[model samples]
Target chain A: MATTTVSPPAPGAAVPGRRRRTPLARREARWAWLFLAPWIVGFLAFQAGPMIASAWLSLTEYDVINPPEYTGLDNYRELMADPQVARSLGNTVYYTALHVPLVMLISLGLALLLKRVGRLQGFFRTVFYLPVMTPAVAVGILFLLLLNTQDGLINRGLALVGIDGPSWTTDPDWVMPGIVLMSLWSLGSTVIIYLAALQNVPRDLYEAASIDGAGAWARFRHVTLPMISGALFFTLVVNTIASLQMFTEVYTMYFGNRQTQTSFNSDAATFYVIHLFQEAFQFLHMGYASAMAWLLFLIIMGITLVQVKLSKRFVYYEGEDQ
Target chain B: MLFVAALVGAAVIFMLPFVWLISASLRPREYVFAPGFLPVPFAPENYAEAWRAVPLVTWLLNSLVVGVAAAAAVTLSSAWVAFGFAYFRFPGRNLLFGLVLATMMLPFAVTMIPTYLIWSELRLTDTQVPLWAGNLFGSAFYIFLLRQFLLSLPREYFEAARMDGASYPQLFWKLAFPLIRPALLVAFVFEFKASWTDLLKPLIYLRDEHLYTLPRGLKVVLDRFGYGGEQQWEVVLAGSVISTVPMIILFFLAQRHFIEGIATGGRKG
Candidate 1:
């Protein structure tokens, strides 16, 4: 890595030797702004603006047809008071806790398997990733069909093995397990990341480990893990954020019926975003949803900050290793 | 030999959906109950009947329009932003780039409802605009991906363009675009795949039967067929197979980039 010297700016001094903005530079800036205008407008109009609105809305008692009444902390207070909200939050954390680690593990395992397979590397990779290309709606439907109570293939297969299968979707206990299973099948994206990390690991480290008579597990622990810790951190952070915001599977499979508005059964799967959707769209509590959104933002930020802070303990950077 | 068997086993398991979809599609309506590997007395009309049952062709076209529009929009916008970040030094450039990265953390959940409201207020809902426009800002992920690729290119090429009085647009369009075709194609395939298989936004926004995408269209078929209990079992499976086949073909066609993007690289933040 290269480092540059840092210069201190003079205190309370207007620097006379600042780089002048040239005509070409100005022209480029204008073009840059023009090129970036859509994104700027979109961020302002959709993301940032709504987030601001949602924050404000979270404090008010607002329905769709009526103007929001200022009811400071009422929504938050209600959120604290609501058992269903608590259940939804608990369910979300449970789902994330169960899903993210499982996903990371399987994806890494699959990637390692592919790494071991030398000849048909490209072919096997493509086969595993085919599911990633399939849409969530299709995935949900496919799983729904697979998990059907009586005639579903999964149940039938279980029967063939002389074991009866539980009702997968309808039963609350099995429903989450079914969701976890579906998630495991779609670990293609993470597997790709692991493969990339694996490729980046220097061959010399493994060679050195072998020379030292280290077993495969020991080599992996000391060599592979450290080398790819950067990628692992990146993947872990991203997977955390994405898993926390999961919605499409439940929305497609459970709540596609528009009639059952704000019910907790589907909302039982309300991993954070679904709750925000429910508040903002279903109940027209835009302000409350906004607060929830901000809370979500803060929670994610806090968690990520803590992760980055604590990353030094486990994350082995090459420069640091030297 | 063991390795080959393991790979084969995994492939077969992964390929189960495609096999089940096709087999179920070909079975006679009454033969749905039969306990057999093959669909007894194959009903070829299942395909035709599924086609008639829903606006399958129209839905496919709608999906194409949305997919192409989104793919193009994301590709162009990402390239532009990526070029700026990769090549230029300006005030707040690093901060702006950091801001873009930070946006990646902002959950779609936070934005989904407000986006719908804004579109509804603008009366852009139910049109293809919402579908394509959802991607118009260019994704943080793609921008980052493109920027990574762009950084690896020789800087002197752009400097040479500048020395020759090549305008930014000219440099971007003529120089950058062609050189980064591989990265651009990767982004295109990604955006295309996401939009093509997307069901939620379309389901929420598009109510018109003619405007539905394939996933949404397939749902209509499933609902009409209404799970395994009803008689239209073969037709349901046939429609699913029909919906899945194009993607299967596209997967085979772009298998190189798709595999590269998913199996080994392009996903790290």
Candidate 2:
């Protein structure tokens, strides 16, 4: 109110008059800048400078022990030709392929069950979602103990059923699968997301399908699936991105046991990010690591763009002008 | 119905690791190898041994400090930034907000090297500053989350404050903040979980043993004791159980707010 009285615009003043506008505009800008100072400084010191430096560092062959030398395109070319990169990429793709679908299925099941339950839904939902709160590192260790070869509880349980469980981590064939199984521990968050989406689904659609003599599976297919496809697609995009960056489980499982010298069998579990980490810090190949980071950026960007493009065909929006 | 049975079955299977963790933690040294769901003669002392094995109390204190500090920093700064974007008109506002969100796409791998370089140059590698420094900038996720909440609030509140001669800071403190306390609390829980569970930053930054957080300390315990002998397994399991306890407790305490936060945050997406 004081500001309104102190600063009044003349009715006859020219629109965009420099005298009247500049000071007020400047005042607004100052306030905005004051509000934005922290984020901007952080972005510059932590984000922009680092991003540009990493981009430049990608072209130079710099180990920490020696000065960087310009080796234009060599890192890129080597990355193109490297079998290890190819192997890691292949392993990552395989891991994502297996893991994402399983995650979607399990989370969808949880969400649907919670939605259908008439009583104590809150209790069940909370119980099922506890894994999201568990520390991921601890979960990795717990899985390691459970999947260990000799005294593992998983093997013991299987033995009682007249089946023998393979060494989950050391065996090359089982390594990625073990990672996938371990990954299910954190499905709580995804289930929570799906549950939220399911809650938003219109009740009438299910009732309509029921009136048409639809069975549970038929109703789910005709009503539930179509209704939640937007959430489904959103989850897929986020999940794909998250799964592509899966490093913690592998690092903990493999590196945590590095003293044992238990060969990961085929490097099948060495994901792309893990390999990039090795090159950057462990091997001190900053330039090569930069190139690897850029390549991953491009790969993730490409996948995300493809998903965005493909979303139009599958994702349904309710009551939109379209 | 078969569906109920199937869901129950799946829930039990899903909860196996948690059950095993508690079981293994409670089992006596002799009964560890004896395969069963129940532990005979519960060794509650394992929790004590686990406590003494590492400076877990110190780790807990460190974790609480980092978590609370990060949560406070993120909520305050993000709410301030969100208020500006939601309430005020300014030049380059949209561009700046978009830039803020765009940075989210830049993964840590791209920034880790340069960040480490800057921190090492500043001689902050051995302190908790590196962990908390990232929070000062306002993470993209929290910023976006708060912005959505702030945007949905009635604009009349800000306009009324302006009519009452309130400056931006006063409006933020007295009016906008109280209304958005729920959102701020939700962001607190998120930021807390992120800081608490974070392993990589602390592993990279803190060099001294006493400075180690829970996850990093768990790694040390796992390496030192999880192997070499059968008795060590009990200690490690007990340690793992100890490390996981606070999170379980925190989840129970904050579960309602957390779920609501997730639901609300998810709705906009």
Candidate 3:
């Protein structure tokens, strides 16, 4: 050991003899920062640089072949009037509004049921998480098969039970709902998070609730809910953000004849990200798409802020002792 | 009795889609609309047919390359960066780590145009560079997970390593890296899955057929072969089956550590 760690300074050493920063500590800090160099560079180039560029790009009309021209918020103004933007908004909100809550309920319920199961805890966990591991594109393809109007497995099965199934993806009204169901199928990780949180809740609280003659639902509402509020809030925010960015699944699900479809279908299920993608890539409306991107960012931030504020009242954080 | 009902009910809901998918994949071409869940007169050659139809080998290889490379980059760089955050107490450490979390919320759309411009400017588009290039730097989520894992580690090793004159780099590569292998595995599997399944990146960057990854290849296959009278789904389902089965096996194998990673991530404020 070189002991090159010793610094030149004892000048700050007082009657209490507070130590100065050692060479080794200084070297460690330097090394730490060095280790983070790749990330620092990446964050600047990929994240911060693009963010600033996007704000600027949103205000202009830039075509990839030509240089960006200063248009003074024309893209923003256009976005305000764009019918496509409106359709994208309607579609996104439709998906998120149902998808988030549905996923939450399913995930939480699965966690609760799994907790009570005498055996097969691991089996249930594995089964639930399997879909999460499946690729979104594959799920989209499977849904295209399963959600077929007549011959598909879903309708075939439904007929056995004396029920009819809708043309899920093709039907304007059912499209978003179909996508939501597909996304909901992968709530495995969310359930795992909730299950972990559920396990941490004090058993005594449940016991106390039961002793007070509260039934299962009553105990769940009062005791269980508050205990895992943090996890609930976490899932809510994450699910909302993800659902708002819905694309690959919807895009692939309807990848059939894209030239004729999304454009003519009233944009019913063309999600915000998909719409933005088509604008930027397909139509070369880079500046307009960038504007939409900024708006999406604002919307996500606003939703998160609202969730934070809302959860402040509902989410329970216990003291360190408990 | 009610608990049993709930358990079975939840299990059915969770398992049905997969069961249907697996069943459909194995069903004979003509019997695709067969009445039951089981694939009667099972067609075992669906896998072989799908393997031959598309360049499943090429796409799988591409995806594997991207997945393995991205995972390697992610595991190492994220662990390195997270090591910095977790092990060292420095000025602005908390603020910087907060920046890491904050970056996660910035959607890809916000950054896509410029980043694409950057890649295109460097002539990297229509190639695979754009997909895995940025991954080499690491992601905020994995960084946070690795940092969380590192925070729990005992500092006793640092003293002994210091006595042995080991520098921070040596300590990181030699000591901390092995100890945090579990967290690294979690990050690796995550990045691998992400890279393999990622559609948006490949969609934006790779336009060449040969360059297409599995997801993109699968999409192309669906668009082309998806039309159908017969033999269509056998191929498509086979492709889907091929795409799905590996990840499922991986999930089962690394099940515990994988859940631990997710649980660890959610546990923090």
lDDT of each: 0.74, 0.79, 0.83
Q: Is the docking of candidate 3 incorrect, acceptable, medium or high quality?
A: medium
Candidate 2 deviant stretches above 4 angstroms = A1-25, A210-215, A256-258, A262-266, B228-231
DockQ of candidates 1 onward, in order? Answer: 0.41, 0.50, 0.57
lDDT of 1 by residue, A1-322 (tens): 0112122331222347766755655776777776667667767887788777666777887775687899999878777787766776777778878898898887777788888888788777777777776667667767776777787777887898998898887777788777887777777778777888788788998999999999989999999888877777777787777777777776666664543323325644555676666667667777777667767777788878898887879887775532
Residue ranges of candidate 1 with Cα displaced over 4 Å: A1-22, A258-272, A320-322, B33-36, B227-231, B262-269
In model 1, pairs of residues that clash are A54-A290, A57-A287, A57-A288, A58-A287, A58-A288
Tens digit of per-residue lDDT, candidate 2, span A1-322: 0011122432123367345655545666677687778788888988999999889889999886687899999999999999999999999999899888999998898888777777867777777777777777788778888888777888888888998899887888888888898887688777888888888888898898899999989998888788788778877877888888887656765664555435345486789988888887778898999999888888988998998899888888786552
Candidate maximizing DockQ: 3
Q: Write the per-residue lDDT of candidate 3 for residues B214-267, one digit (tens) a residue.
A: 999888888777752233877887888788887888888888878988887666
> If the candidates were sorted by their TM-score against the true structure, best first, what order would they fall in?
3, 2, 1
Per candidate, native contacts kept equal 0.39, 0.54, 0.72
User: lDDT value for candidate 1?
Assistant: 0.74
